[model samples]
Structures are given as structure tokens and as C-alpha cells.
Target chain A: MWEIARSNKRKSVIFVFLMALLLVLMGGVFGEHFAQSAETGLLVAFVIWVILSIIAYFQGRNVFLAVSGAHKIRKEDHPRLFNIVEEMTIASLLPAIPEIYIIDDPAPNAFAVGRKPDSAAVAVTSGLLNTLNRDELQGVIAHEIGHIINRDTLFMSMLGVMLGSIVILSEIARRSLFFGGGRRRTRTSSSGGGQIQVILMIAGLVLMLLAPILARLIYLAASRKREYLADASAAIFTRLPEGLASALEKISVSPIRLRKINQVTAPMYTINPLQNMKLAEDSLFSTHPSTLNRVRILRSMAGGSGYDAYDAAFRAVTGQTRAIIPPSALKTAHATVPSRSRRSDPKSDPGTDQTKQAPSAMGMAGAVLTAAVLMDAAAEPVTPAAKVRETTDAIWKSRGYRFIPCPCGAALKVPPDYRRTDIVCLRCGRKHPAASAS
Target chain B: MECPVCRESMIVIEYDDIELDYCVGCMGVWFDAGEIELMLGKSGIPFPSEALRFRVADTDARELRRPCPLCGKTMQKVCPEHGRVILDRCPAGEGIWFDAGEIREVIKESAGAAGDIVLGALRRYLGEALAEK
Candidate 1:
């Protein structure tokens, strides 16, 4: 794991360095065309890059959470999600558990963010919790943790900031040129170096137009491979490739598109939220491998849930000789997959059994879902409606909505802005006072 | 979100995981498109995509146009087949708006078990607020 993460970090640094160089070149060209000196543009671009990188290093995670409207939740708010995250954290051998957040949107997606593993956070949509089963949810959380462990979050942020700066600089230059603000500078420089100045201006204009697209391609190229690595990491951590494969299937087929996502944050998601369903095939501009390909790779991992197995599966599915997992990481990989029955059997594994017990005990106290329900879920799948309700209830709880349980087995959620002092129960026609209920 | 009918800030009421934005002033309900699909889909009922699709009903031309609570665009009156309940659906497919009495009427007019399940859930939750004529 360390070897894989270290190699990933090394590759990330190279990508960031190359993108930074691209940004500086763009700045220099635009500056020469507009301000008549490459030094000023280069310095300006460098300063912009430094400032943006600093901000991303310190506050990128918070900015992402705020932009996506994710609200942080405590263990009591959503124990199931918290438990899954904790289990994955332990399984991945991380030093600290990442903070958990929930997005209210019904789109089933998730992402991880932070500059370091210890400070990282994982966020999932309410739709995700509502949609996925326990095994599937675990698979998704493990995948996000895969990103954190692989240092993809920090790398992606730095790359995103560089991408942003390139886009902004080019946009400003394009607008300035379009509005004829560069004409005066061109005319002034024309007297000193007439022919060369005209050539330089045209070259700068072309560069400015091509710079953003180039930066986006670089960003997308860097992003797509990391997703496969993370997927492999998730499989090894959970020992359940089917969980992730099915979850990807559900996510890809989901009809609802994420409302709050933008170009910059789109790649951070488990799946590219911005990609249209019809256009989900592999493309130069795509931030992720095609879902079909990813799922096929995971499903075809015949040997075991290991880096070596994933490598073989990748080759089989894509018909490419190139390996996805680093050879060094594969040296220390597990030889065999643990059986599914052993994992499901609470008595067989004490470590996992303890984790399950904690949540079930808490569930008993809250009267949310009893041990019997959990057991039933383990045996036969629970209805999607029940899972959706449980997940949404957690979101409401995090947002300060009060839950009032009625005798008719209905738990009514009263909004914070509910002005009425007394509210009637939606079930059983029983009336309860809002002030006293809380 | 502000109610399109009464223009009053609405209070969200969550029951069985489906959130309904209810206007206290007019007793009207706003059913978001996403939530409706989730509710129907989870319940194993086929989503009434045809009924909810943007179709301008020429019958209610005299009714004042109401802006959709979500997109702020003027909503078109759509009357689902097999029902006389004219609903204000966002042209952008945001959601549907039902006046106080219209919800019950739509439920009554709706075909098969799909309507009964929704009606039962709504009646159980909203009680007299939805039962009122």
C-alpha cells in the first residue's frame, strides 16, 4: 500500500509540475501580447498559481463541501454511514477516520477530499445511501478511501487549481483581444519590432485559445487512470469486487443528474457526474474510464481481490498489455480472496462482528432499525424504501430537524422553520405539540 | 422554496422519505420531480413519465400563469390522461403543483394500484389537510 501510494504521489508531482509549466507559458505569451513583456506575464501567472495552490492546500476540501451543499454529520446522525466509513478506514490501515458528510441531492454519487489522509473527508449523496445496499455502500466508501490512501485527492485539487488558473488567464486574454484592448499595445510594439510583433501577437492568440483545452486534456488524462487504481484498491480492501461493480452499474444507470456539480469538481466524484449518459463512452475529454469497462474489469477478476488479480482482469477486459497496478505493489499483494460466507457470518470474524454489534446496539436505542431488521437485511435484502427513509432521516437530523415518533409507527420529520406550535401526525391522525416533542 | 400559487415560503414535510413542500397559506403541495420518481420507483410502480411530460393543455387558457417554484419559469397546465385534475408542471421538468383539492382528485382519477398507494400514504400523513374539500 505504501509503495503504491508513494508511486502515485511521485506521478502526481510530475503531472502538477508539467501543468504549472503550461500555465506559466500561457501567462508569458498572453503577457507579451498584452503588456509587451514576458517577465510580467510569467510573474503574474506564477503568483496566480502560487496563490491558488496555497488556497487548495489549506481550504480546498471545505470549498468543495460548501459548493456541493454537503453538511457534516456526527456518528449519531447517521450511524450506518459512519460505521461503514470506520470499517473501511480500519481495513485500509489509515491513521484516522475521514470526516463524513451528506449531500441532500438525490443523485447517487460520492467523493473524497483533503490534502492528506489524516485530514481527509468523504461525502456521499442522500440518494447514494438510499439506493445502495450495505455491501454496496461499503464498496463505495472503500473506493473513496482508496482515493485518499492513493493521494489522489490532494493531487486532483492542485491540478484543478492549475486548470482554473489556465482557464482564467486565457479567458481574460481572449476577452481583451476580442474587445480590442490589445490593439493599443500591438500598435505601440509594432513601431519597435513591426513584423515580429504581429507574428508574436497571432501566436499568443492561438496559444491562448488552445491552452484551456490542452490543460483540460491533461487533467482528464491524469484523472482517468487514478479511478481504476482506486477501484482496484477498493476491491482489495473490501475483498468484494462484485459490490463495487454493481454499485457502478446502479450509479451509471441512475436517471437523476447531480444539480450542484461543476466542471472543476466533477472529476472528484466516484463517477463523473457531468458526463451525459449517451456520451459516457471513453473520450479524450472524459474524466473517467467508461463505466461498462470498469465494471467488466472488476467482474472478470477471476483469481482473487488483489492488485495482481485486478491487473490480470484489466488486461483481459481491455485487451491491453499495459498493467494498471504497479509491479512493486503487486509483489506484496494477497494471494487469495476471502470467501463471502466467512465475511457474512458474524461469528467467524470478531473484528467485523464488533463493528456490526456497535451499530445494532445503537439502532436499538434509537429504535431506527432493530437487530432483527439488520439480521433480516443480512439474510434477505431490505426494501429500498426503508433504506431511503433511514438515509434521509439522517440528513434531516444533521440539519436540525426534530423527529417525532407516533404510535402508528410513523416517524414524522418536522422542519426547523415549521411555524405551527402544534402539528398533527401524518399517521394515525394524532396531534402532538411541536415545542414539547423536541 | 416559495409556493407558486400563494407566493408564501413553503415548509417541507417529510413522510416515508418523500419530502413535500407544503404552503401553509394556500394548503397547496409541491412535488419535486426527483422525489416523485424516487417514491414511485422504490414502490415498484412505473413512473408516470407520459403524464408528467411537458404538454400545454389548451383548456385552462384563462387561468393565470404561475411560475415554477424551482426554475422560476412560467409553468404549463398539464392534464394527465384519465383525470380531470389539471396540474401546473414546470416547462423545464422541475416538478408538479397541486392545489388543495386537486391532489385528492388526481388520486381518485388515477388508474390502478399506483394511485391508491400514493393516496393512502398521503391521506395517512396529511389527514384533514388533504381530506378537506
Candidate 2:
């Protein structure tokens, strides 16, 4: 894992440099064409790059959380989610548990963001929480932690910002050209070196138009491989390949598209929320490898839970000689596969009895018990409605909504900004003072 | 969420883990698609595939069209197979909007265990409001 992270960091530096060069070239060309000064264009582009980098480096995680409409939640708010994250953290051997966040959107998706594992935060949409069971949720969480472990989050953010800079620069250039900047350039350049200036201007215009697409291509090419690695890591961490396989299946087939996602942040998610699942084949523009391919590779893992098994599965499923996991990592990783049974099921595994004597075991047991009770209490056994309800309630609670329970068995959730003093129950018509209910 | 009818902010009312956005000003209710599914699925109610097969109702041409609260698009009016109630549904299938007393009317006219459960819950919680008229 450390080797992977080190190599990832090295690749990230190289990628950043390449993108920076692209930004500078684009800037210089645009500036030379528009301002008739290459130095000024170069300077402007460099400044934009630096400002974006600084913002991404320092406040990128918070910016992502805010933009995605994610609200930070304490452990008490959604204990199931927090517990799942915690279990994955311990399993992954992460330095600290990443802060958890919840997005209110019903589209099932999740992403992790941070410069480093210790400072990381993992956010899942309410739909993901509502849709997935414990094992599937663990699978998704493990994949995210896998990204954090491989330092993919940091690389992706920096790359995303650079991509943003290129897109913005090109957009500005395009708009200016569209709105009569071309006429001004032609007028100014017709004096001396007219032929060469005209040629250069055309070349610059072409570059400006292609820069964003070029940057996006580069960005997409680099990200797709890391997703497979994260999937492999998720499989290894959870020791349950089927869990993530099923999760990928569910997420890919979900009919609801994420409402808050845009192209730039779309690559950060477990599956590209912006991309149509039907068109999710390996492509130059895709931010992720095909979900079908990923699920197949995970499900095809023969026996081992190590990187070796994952590499073998990858080759077998993709029919490619090139290994996804590095040979060195494969050599170091011991071939050991844990039993595929649900590890969290206390009833199925009596080993939990021995672990229950430990202090932390109590909390784990309680969470499991609570989950069990909730699942059992549901009238329909398969829908996981109780879990969905709990997840949504947690989201509401985090948003500072005051929960007022009516004697008639209806719960009234008054928005924090609600100025009304009284709320009439929809089920029983009992009027309750909002301020006094709490 | 703002009410589609009155444009006033609505409060959430939850029963059986299902949340409905209730408008105080218009006495309307918004049932989110996902939440309704969860609620129905929880109560062991089999949601008919054709239940939400909404078509543009031509009879309510004189009525003002309301925008969907979830997505600010003009909602299409649809009359369900079991009821004469003309409900507003988002074109994007975000949810259904019940105006004023439309929920009770739907409950009274609709048949099956699903309607019974919904009606019983509504009567228990909003007894006085539903009893009026």
C-alpha cells in the first residue's frame, strides 16, 4: 500500500507538471493572440493556476463538501454509517477515521476527499445509505478508503482544479473570440509580420478550443486506472469481493441520476454519476472503467483476498496481460483469503462472543443489534426501509430540524427557520406548540 | 421545500418513517417518489407499476398549473385510475402533489390495503382537518 501511495504521489507530481505546462501554453497562446503579449498571457495563466492550486490544496475538501450540499454529521447522528466507516478504517489500517458527511440527494453515490488519509473525509449520498445494506455499504466505504490509502483523492482534487483552470481559460477565450475579439486581433495584427501573425492567431485559436478537451482526456485517462486499484483495495480490505460486486451492480443500475453532480466533481465518485451507465464502457472521455468490468473482476476473484488474487482476476476478466497491481506489491502481498461469510453478522459467527468481552465490542455489538432490530422490525423483509428511514432521519437531524413526536404516532419535523409557533399533526390533527414540543 | 400551490415553505410530517412535505398556507401535501415507495414497501404494500403512469389530464385546462417543488418545472395534472382527484405530478417523476383536501378525497375514493393504511394513518393524525368538509 505504501509503495502504491509513493508511486501514486510520484505520478501525481508528473501529471501536475504536465497539466501546468498545458495551462501555461494555453495562457501564453491566448495572451499573445488577445493581448498581443505572450508574457502577459503567460503571467495571467500562471496566476490563475497558482490561485487554483492554493485553494485546492488548502480548502479543497471543504469546498467539495459544501458544493455537494453535504452536511457534516457526528457519530451520534448516523451511528450505522459512522460504525461502517470506523470498521473499514480499522480494517484498512488508516491512521485515523475520516470525518463522515451526508448528501441529501437520492442518487446513490459516494466519494472521499482529502490531501492525506488522516485529514480525509468520506461523504455518501442519502440515497446510498438508504439503498445499500451493511455489507454493501462496507464495500463502498472500503473502496473510498482504498482511494484515500492510495492518495487518489489528493491527486484527483489537484488534477480537477487544474482541469477547471484550463476549462475556464478556454471558456473566456472562446467567449471573447465569439463577441468580436477576433476583429480587434485582426485589426491590430495587419500592420507588420501580418502573414505569420495571422497564422499564429489561428493556431492559438485552435489550441484554445482544444485545450479543455485535451486536458479532460488526460484527466480521464489517469483516473480510470486508479478506480480499478481502489476496487481491488476495497476487495482486499473487506475480504468480501461479492459485497462490492453487488454494490457496483446496484449503483450502476440505479435509475436516478445525481442531482448535484457536475462534470468536474463527477470523477471523484465511486461510479461516475454524470456518465450514463449504458455508455460506461472504457472510453477516452470516461472518468471510470466500465462498472460491468469492475464487478466482473471482483466477482471472478478465485480464492485469495490479496493483490495477487485481484491481479489474476483482472487479467482473467479483462483478458489483458498487463497487471493492474504492480509486480512488487504482488510479491509482497501474502496469498490469504478470509472466509467469505458476512463478518459483521454476530448471530452467524460465535467468535463475536469472545470479542464481546473487549470494551469496543460493546458498541459494535450494540450497533449490530440495533441494525438487526431495525431490519427485523420492518414489515417487508427485503426492502431495507427501516435503514432508509433511519438514514433520512439522521440527515434531517443534522440539518437542525426539530423533531416533535405527536401522541398520535406522527413525527413533525419543523425546519429550523420555520417561524410558525404551532404545527398541526397530519395524522391526528392535534395542535402542538412547536417551541414547547422540543 | 416551498409549496407548489401557495409558494410558502412547507414543513415535513413523518408517519411510519415516511416523510410528507405539508404546506401550512395551502393545506397541501407533497409526496416524494422515493419516500412514498419506502413507506409503501415498509407497510408490505405492493406498489402497482401503473400507479404512477401519469398522463396529461385535459379536463383541468382551466386550472392554474403548479410547478414541482423538487424541480421547478410545470407539473402535469393526472387523475389516478381509482379516484377523480386530479393530482399534480412532476414531469420528471420527482413526486406527486396533493392540493388541500385531495389526499382525503383520494383515500375515500381509492380501494385496497394501501389506501386503508394511508387513510387510517391520516385519520389518526389529521382527524379534525380531514373531518372538516
Candidate 3:
């Protein structure tokens, strides 16, 4: 195992070294082609590539967060989440605790990015926060920490930068050769420069091909071992492999699939974010290890047996694994729909309490915030239970029963007589149904 | 791992098949050395409403030294987050102990309550946007 790790690391270093060398060599060759031919257009284009890469590097994370709609959190805003993070930081011995952000998505997925532990940021979809119990959650958190501790986050971001840098440079050179230049410039060159143009043309083609190859190579080098490392580290941190193994089992079965993951960031997560994928088929181009394989390794370390004990068990249950669970419905008590439709009241079930609290708490605040965020109405928490009761009654009385202030936030309807029956909201189709049971 | 609060035998309880350490007596949980790190880092689904009412209490105030649940070596209370939630974890990468309700309480506090409000807001925002599942 150590030897495999060593050889892989050596290969990664050598591959990076070779890529850097090729770019430098490719740059020089391209430089000679342009200068000798004296094509003003190509020269200006090459300059632009250098300039843009520098600009994108500093602003990349910001650009991604904004376009992806990530919200930043201060410890005070969500003390519980922040406190847990605070706890994790001390235990991990990390140089920096990553800034936490939530992506307003229902998928139970998260990814860590930035160059290293000090520079990293970990973002989770709201769906993820709503799903796992604390122990399973800890297991997941440990996995992410494993990514950071192993330096995979930094590796990925840097690889993104490098890939971007190379592509920009390559494109500039290619376009300049064809279109002359980005700005107004001299077009025709002396016949003596004809040979140089041929070389420039050839280099442009090579660079184009190298662009994708370069990106893949970086992923191959950055991804493979780091995932294993994070898994091992997560097991080490939790000191209970079953926690993470169980987490993987739940995540595999979750309704919300990872939506934020793309070709660029797909490899950075513990599991491959792209769903409906088989590792054996996609591993050729992918950065993540197979789920079955990971589950097996975790199970081995966990020292116990369960549904995920063997690969066949996981494969049989993991039908189309990429579904992204929704967040908006998560806080609604009515979200636990299965319990609601059961012969008895959903609340009667043992699971309702855990299911209802998250959604209903959100349901109340969400209604308040929804009004605020949508209608531009400023509001605060309704402290008096009467205020809550009043809102619930008003909602109950309103025609169409459009809105529900139930702590679970499910849009509900209660027959005047069955008020005791507690008609819950239809399952928002996220998790189990009615969020109101608790 | 021995329960920090009780110095009693710790039992591992698997909820929903997810393993967690429990104290046989006090019901507090001491998440393994970095277990807190793991839990906090991974995002989870909503906590069941039934699990939310649990609260953490230092069940045993009498004793400090405890036997290592995994290694059988004597263990001491070590502050993981510096006095907030001390741990009875193996100094090595072995497992740790939980005093009965510790795991449940942490899960409840973290997964229940106000955190869900923000998560719900985020969930709606994200859920509707993707509209996938």
C-alpha cells in the first residue's frame, strides 16, 4: 500500500513536472514562431492570455460562489453549525478552519475547494444538513476534513488554475494565428516569414490537443490517491468506520443528487457527485473512486457487518444514485409524507419527532423569511406562542389554505372536524413526508 | 471507551444502522478523537422530530479517570474544543466512548432547532432552483 502511494505520488510529481516543461517548451516554440514571422496579431493575443490567467486566479472562487448562489455564514447566524465546525477544527489539528457556506440546493452533497487547509472553503447543500443524524453527519464531516488534511482541495483548485492558464494561452495563440489579433494590427507579413507561420500553425494544433489532455492528467494525478487518503482519515477521525460506511449508504440512497458538481469540481468530493455512473465504466476519465469499492474499504475498517457489508448489497440498492435531494421541503414537517398517510397520525410514529423539528422550525421561519425575501417585508421571529397560533389559525382560515405557518412549513389542510387528525401537508417529495408529526 | 461521566461500560448503539457509542449508565457520548470533526464536516438529512427533545447532562460528576473502552488503558478527560465538550478518546486512532445521551444530544442540537430554519430556507431556494428530485 505504501509503495503504491509512493509510486503514484512520484508519477504525479513527474507528470506535473513534464507538463510544466511542455508548456514552457511549447511557449518558447510558439514565441519563436510569432516573433520570427512578425505577426502583430499573434503577439497581442499571447499577451492577453497571460493577463487573463492572472486575473482569473484571484477571483475564481468569488465568481463560482456568486454564479452558484452560495451564501456565506458567520458563526453567530447559525451557532449550532458553527459550533460543530469549531469542535471539528480543534480535533483535526488543522492550521485553519475553513469558512462555511451553504448552497441553497436540496442535494445532500458538499465539496471543499481552495489551495490548502488555510485557504479552503467547504460548502454544503441545505439538503445535506437536513438529512443525516449527528453521528452520520460527523462521519461525513470527517470525510471532508480528510480531503482538506490530505491537501486534495488545494490540489484541485490549483489544477483548475493551471488548466485554465494553459487553455487561455493555447487559445490566444490559436486564434491569433487564424484571426490576426484581438485588436487592430498589421495583417500581412513578408514572404520570408512563411516558414515561421507553418511552425506557428503546427504548435497551435498541438496546444489544442494538449489542453484537454493536460486537464485530465492533472485530475488523474490530483484525484486518485487523495480520495483514499480522505476515506482513511475519516475512519481515523471517527475511529468508527461504520459511521462513514453508513453515511455512504444513506447518501447513496438519498433523493437529492449533487447538482453543483461539474466536470471541473467532480473529482474533489468523497463520492463522485455525478450520479447514474458506474466507476468501472467512468473511471477512465473520472477522479472519484467507485462507491462499491469505497464502501468495501470502509466496511473492512469498520469491523462490523451491515447492509453495506458487501458490494452486492450496495449495488443492488443503489439504483440511479445521482438524484439531488431538495432543501426547500426539508424543513417542512409535512415533508415526512409517508408518516402522514399512515393509518394513524404521522406524529404517532416514533420517527416523526426528528422528522418534524427541522422542517417546521424552518416552516415558521421560512414563511416569515419568504414574506420578507419575496415581498420585501421585514420581519423577526414571533416570540409569543400566540403569534404563532394566530398565524397558524389565520393560515387555516384563509381561503385556498395557501400558506402554512406550522413549524414544519408544509402547506396543509385540516378538516374542521379532523383538526384533531392534524391534516398535514402533502410530502414535498424530498425526504419522507409530513414535517408536522413532531 | 469508558464513559467519562460514569466510568462505566460503554455500549455502541447503532441507530438507523449508524454506529454511535453510548454510556451504559449516564447516557452521554464521547465521540472518538476526531468524530466531532467528521460529523460537523459532512452535511446530513433532517433530524427526526423524536430525536430533538434529548438534552445533554453530565451524568456523573464524581469521577475523572476512566478505563479506555477500546485499549483498556486508563484515560483522562481531554478538552477537544477546549472545555466545551471534553473527550475520552484514545490518544491513538482507536475508537472513543459516549455517555448515553451525548451522541443523541449532539445530533439533536445540531440537527434540530434553528439550524433547520436556515437549512429550510436554503433547501427551498436550492430545491426549487434545481427542481431535479
Q: Report the number of clashing residue pairs per model.
A: 1, 9, 77
TM-score of chain B of each: 0.78, 0.76, 0.44
Residues B1-133, model 1: lDDT tens digits: 7879777656556655567777666778788878766766656667766534444577646668899999999998887676666789888988899887787777666644566666655564555655645
Best by DockQ: 2
Across A342-399, the per-residue lDDT of candidate 2 in tens digits comes to 5444454434433345446544312211111113221222557677778888898888
lDDT of 1 by residue, A208-292 (tens): 8888999999999999999999999898778778889889999889999999989999999999998886226678989999999
lDDT of each: 0.79, 0.79, 0.49
Model 2 has an lDDT value of: 0.79
Each prediction's TM-score versus the true structure: 0.78, 0.78, 0.47
> Which residue ranges in model 2 land beyond 4 Å of their true spot?
A179-192, A333-340, A343-382, A418-424, A431-438, B1-11, B23-125
Name the lDDT value of residue A183 in candidate 2. Answer: 71
DockQ of 1: 0.25
DockQ-better candidate, 1 vs 2: 2
In candidate 2, list every pair of residues with a backbone clash: A426-B126, A427-B124, A427-B125, A427-B126, A428-B124, A428-B125, A428-B126, A429-B125, A429-B126
Q: Model 2: iRMSD?
A: 2.1
